[model samples]
Target: MSNSPTPSLVKNGKEDFHHVEGLTSPNSHINVGDDYANNVNAKIRNPLLGISKPDLLAQVTAFCKEHDLEDKTSVFRKGSLLAQHPESFEDIEELDEEDKITIREEKTHKWRLPWALYYTVAICSLGSAIQGWDNTGANGANLSFPKEFGIENNTWLVGFVNAAPGISGLMSTWVADPMNNWVGRRGVIFITGLFVIFPVLGQAFTHNWWSLLICRLLMGFGMGIKTTTIPIMTSEIVPAAIRGGLVMSFQLFVAFGILVGFCSNLVFYRIGPLAWRFQLAAAFAPAVPIVILIWFCPESPRWLLKKHRYKDSFRSFCRLRNSEVIAARDLYYAHCQFVEEEEAFKGTTLAQRAKEIFTIPRIRRANLGGAIVMVAQQFSGINIMSFYSSTIFKEAGSNTLETLLASFGFGLVNFIFAFPAIWTIDTFGRRNLLLFTFPNMAWCLVAAGCCFLIPAENSARLPLIAFFVYLFTALYSPGIGPVPNVYASECFPLSHREIGVAFSIFINNTLSSILGLTFPSILSGMGPTGAFGFYAGLNMVAFVIIFFFLPETKQRTLEELDYIFGVPTRRHAAYQTRTWLPWFIKRYILFQSNARLEPLYHLEGLSGGTTVEVMAIH
Candidate 1:
């Protein structure tokens, strides 16, 4: 593909510059005059675009001096030029052999990153495991804990005990904005780690239901902070091209923790009443490594940049990226994007950013989209399996041993299936994966519900129910499982990221709390058949909402998404219904090879106003 810009004059009296075709080159530049720039639809121009080589070099020199990076001015100049015209790197004759080789490797060997980046992501991912283990620990404990506390017969109290963490989590998420601002990402994570460790360990020694509830609720505070910060931390450090895969590590490790939790449940099941204690206490294991090693990892460079610690931000970037040139390019590019973000937001206070999350058109759209996915995740019924699978299996006619084994199978399937999303999330895209999986999951739920009617005497009844439930989990792990955190983390700009993510997670945990508190009653009143069928319908509802509201965000830089979300929600919805849906039928269902789908948002560059139809293809 050619990287050089081609000038195309549009009828609207604007100069347009077309780069390459397709979604791969969606970052094309557009040159417009001052009047057009002030319009609501005006594109955010790249700061370095349309500059002469000498002026670009001078800017890099000044940037280096201002940031106390004068020692790397030569590196900064080339890196800045490459960031200005990313697609046309080869055309820049100023780039040396080493720079060209490193840039090429970025594409060819995208996963060959520095050890420090991998270490940070790995440690952060441990937080997800802590969450997962905490969830499934309760799953196994649900069988024994209630009876021990004499609340087994009281479904409401039983549910309340189970949901205490989620209730506390909902309240804790509101503090995320200020906490992240005051303490930074690493500080919040470390403090939350203490909450996960001690409170979870306290679960093993609880003599009464209320005491256990207090411990779990205390743990939720940590859960809320860690969950809110981890995705944002991972997203800011990774490259945009592979960001979905990396951030989804949060989900992948959660799956692993769930699997381990099940293993703990089974191993301790032989110990009788005390097995529940060990299962609950085992969650603290994952948190230990996170709290211990977090200080060794570099803090988020974007957070540093937000604080105007340019030198520290640059140093942090150096540890996360493979080469100085790559780090310099990312740092400078992020700085440029932040400049635009600050001008647009104009409020440094937590209250102002929180307000912007709801009021600003672009931020509001992102909030809505992120909120939909997070809510959908809970409504998908996966958590029912995660938090109560043992109870569910027992209800389906399994003995205590059989129930533990079945729940273990569910955990294993969840963990194993999550592996595919590591590759498919970025390649197949988030919206496409969700759209494909929801209908399948709905039918699996219906199938599982139907299996309940198979008479208790039948030998195949339990296995059939297990099969369908596992099938539902298989569809979930690759689709809704990983997509929500990845999507919510990347949708908002840096200014509102902490608040925006906290809000989304707040929705997630609140719904989770409701689900945990109500599912036992729901199962009792509606029976497994009715309850499963009801959530199945909700799956379809989630699918429809996602189709209309969620825009495709794969491979787009965090800054580029401003334009994507800036397109009105109504326009996006209308295009999906009136345009893309018909095109999908024609192209795939009707077998029309020539069918073409128009892109919804046109990417405007720095210099001129060019119309580029970036096809929303997987």
Candidate 2:
């Protein structure tokens, strides 16, 4: 047989529309079932292809055809199409009617963030809370798992159980993004939520440590995806003014999750050995409600619109947007502006995207800074203290009664102090609290380390209470608690925010695992002083890194950060406040305390100082 190419139907030497298959998912830019699809579809085309890059597009269309896919159009000028057939840029479509309407919406009145945005954010936050609960709950329960599982003397096994999920989370970063870019956030949440329930249930049912370990790893992957993607979903749904608070809530939810985990584990732990499964199985509790809520949850309209799922995007907006027409109109417009901007940025792959982040000098600084700060959060010894607090109390000469009381107090303080961050975060801004908290965290570790330096038998009760109560929460609430997730998301591009944060969370859990694993070993080698002091040094290094790199992004837009940091002196725009610590020392304490004496940092302030004196400082 001759290996000949099929004849090109040379009678007329022409291609025919006869080869065209029946209708597909409608290649036009319109969202078929959405409120805004037809209009939006008319105005924009596929982001990956040009308005009319014919040569490149034919390739994409052919590939789509061969794959039995629709001949979707590239985002382009109304009534226009791509001119090319590049394998990557084919199947491009023009904006349909709904997309065009969302794009064209230019509202006269500014809209406050809708109340439903709060619910959406709150629910996203709730999912994040589960991740935190999973993360920090283990720390609280570490006291029980070792003896219960026959790993009582095997400290390394204990470490592995605690830290291994974090390792799994690191490798699980890429599942949400780009994938969700096509699938939409709601679908991913539904899928991811369902995925976690099975693993958590498996972990609950398993008797062997190895089986439990595998389940925990799978849970981490599921949780890591949620941690990364939730913030972006929350951010997208929120308006600019409250956005910081809303997105910051996701970070705050981590604390809330830990609080829940702590409380739940404590309750379940006290119920006896049978309760261990209940405590372990408590993992599935959050996912059940989340799955149901996600049923009512909207796909990220921005994502829906981006993927040419305009009807879904519009319906999403309709479901989440307030009943008021003005409010609905305003949200619709922002979506349009965002889509228009997205259309201008053509064909972004992983390398192209990463390169864009790096090419902008300040963005590079911000990205690296945020990444480092997130790493620093894990290294601040919170993990050591969290997983080992009960053990620490036990070792610090506390009997069962004292240890239980201390544990109760620890839970109370963490839950209570978590809110103050919400207030000060917006009022004082991110940089002030974060920078000030670093030195405090450093010294807090030093003080805790010093407790171990003294002979254990000689320790006093008051100082011991101080170590666990005021100092620990102070170190956590502002420094490591909120800053890690807040700063990480604030640094990246809107398009890449979820994926970037996913990796940051991956780093978060990775370090969390390392600390969880190493604490027992470090505890053995260095005792308390050597291990925590090592962490103190790490915090000091972190402060230096943040000082040089992290900028105040408290209330600014992502676009503005680039413009501000592009100039040398302009970088300090939002970080201009003088903190209370530096202010207290320089303006009041050094002079009043005499001879510039070392001012002790007691949380208690002097009441004797007159209102007039306080007024003068302000």
Model number with the top lDDT? 1
- Which 10-residue window of candidate 2 scores lowest in summed lDDT? 1-10
Clashes of each: 7, 52
Report lDDT per candidate: 0.84, 0.57
lDDT per residue (tens digit) for residues 1-618 in model 2: 011111111111121101112221222222222111111111111222222244324533443343333322232122222111111122334434454343334222223335566667777777776676665566555666667678879888988987766778777766666657656677677677875788877766777778878988888777777777777787666544445666778767766666676677667766765555665667677788888887566667666656655445545666664432322333333332344235434466755555544444334555565677778787677766556666777767776446645655665566566677765665566666766777788787778767665666675843564464457665577556776776776666455566566667766777888788878888888887787788889888887666655555554444333323333222232122334345556657566544222211111111211111111101
TM-score of each: 0.92, 0.70
Error of 2 at 385 (Å): 2.8
Q: lDDT score, residue 185, model 2?
A: 75
Q: On residues 1-618, what C-alpha lDDT tens digit does candidate 1 reach at each position?
A: 011121211112121111222212112333323221112342333445565666667667877897788998988887888887776788878788888888998899999899999999999988999889988999999989988999999999988988888899997988988999899999999999999999999999999999999999999988998899999999999998899999999999999999999999999998998889999999999999888999999999999999889889989999998778889888888886675455544545777677667766667888998999999999899888999999888988999999999999999999999999999998899999999999999999999999999999899999999999999999999999999999999999788899999999999999999999999999999999999999999999999999888888887777667656766687777788898989999999999999988766445542233445554632
Q: Which ten residues in a row have the lowest lDDT in candidate 1?
A: 1-10
